[model samples]
Target: MKRKLVIGDIHGGFKALIQVLDRAKVSVDDQLIFLGDYVDGWSQSSDIIQFLIELSEKQNCIFIKGNHDAWCEDWLSLGGTPSVWLSNGGQKTIESYDNYSDEELERHLEFFQRMKNYYVDDQNRLFIHAGYSSMHGPEKEVYSSNYRWDRTLWETAVSMDKKLSKNSELYPKRLLLFKEIFIGHTPTIELGSKEPLNKANIWNLDTGAAYTGALSIMDIDTKEFWQSDPLPALYPDENGRNVW
Candidate 1:
């Protein structure tokens, strides 16, 4: 059987996400894996969450929690300005949920809470929202903080050495157990560069959709990729303001 189709950070651009999935022609039997960041940096967080929930019900949808999703919940808890979300294209997401009842909000929170930290298939295709720490073993260790909040780990993964020292607190060897790993967090210069150092093993798929970059999806078995044109223009005119 073919491996599942994995997608990079969505950042709440539902229109582009739908287009990419349609282009991929994902079927009911095919597995779909999301690398996280389902909300924030786009206007469709609410719709995207609802759509993903529906998708999960109909098909095998594996979701990993992203940094932005963590921030959204935190912001909501503090009654903070979703402005950060809005500036990053979250206004539309808020608009989408304008009619949602309190119960629906609870359901959304529940779904977010239930999202996995990582996914490992039978083939050893590991999927993590952000890169894993080198120190921990392969038993799915949980971090006290959200994966996105760990800037040190992110910077270390993208450092000049590329390899986090085995002795370092956050080592990559722990994840060496997997034949191959797929992740999203740090954005790459291009979709699939061959340079191991330049090409993050994490398989960054975010593609900066909110910043005029393409939205991407990869077929795990074939390593084939599909992308939508950059949608950077979508944010400026949103709500007739420079909110994003």
Candidate 2:
């Protein structure tokens, strides 16, 4: 079967990424949908980007732009350094590219620039780095940043009355926009579950590989998931995101 798998935020945990992919037995025939935040946190951000660029050449992959990725892109392309980004793991991402030549960094910048804000499949399944506030859908969003930075969509889904029928007038129209929505930005670790979470029609795949949690991947159709060992365990000397 050509499985469509949605992956969570990587946060530069390349080793963890490899572990989950291997465990999932992913093949070139499978479609890989990455939820982004490919950089910032661990020490292997640059390596991960390079690997993804290579992987995409032969495998079916969908890359969504993430907030962290946007920050890295600015730094790489314009030499801009936002302090907020540096405080939130951007420094490590910069250090990760120490060995890459200028041309290689440009390649990475191009990769980041080409990422999508959101993707909707033929089945109406939405794959985005974060949520969109537009009731109509991401296409109608007013603020482009919301596609990668908004949390309201997930909050609404999480707080909604589970018993409220979809046909109810109070039902969230945003949730009704898609058959399924896969997102990564908010880590599931903060929710006290180091596993993918499902609320309403939204599936949050960020298991917090940026923090002390694990990397996660899921079969979007089967809902079967595979996780890597705790990211901290994979990189013992590095305090990823230093969130602990």
Tens-place lDDT digits, model 2, residues 48-76: 99999999999999999999999999999
What is candidate 1's lDDT per residue for 1-244, written digit by digit as tens?
5448988877777877888888988788888999888876666778888889889999888988877777666554454555665665556556767888989887787788888877788887777777655445335446645455443444544552656554575555544566666767666534343111123344556666655565788888777888865555555554322322
The best candidate by TM-score is: 2
Where in model 1 is the C-alpha error above 4 Å? 1-3, 75-92, 138-142, 151-172, 190-200, 233-236, 239-244
Candidate 1 RMSD to the correct structure: 4.6
Indicate which candidate wins on lDDT: 2
Cα error, residue 78 of model 2, in Å, equals 0.3
Candidate 1 matches the true fold with a TM-score of 0.78
lDDT of 1: 0.67
- Measured with C-alpha atoms, the lDDT of residue 60 in candidate 1 is 89
Minimal lDDT window, size 10, model 2: 235-244
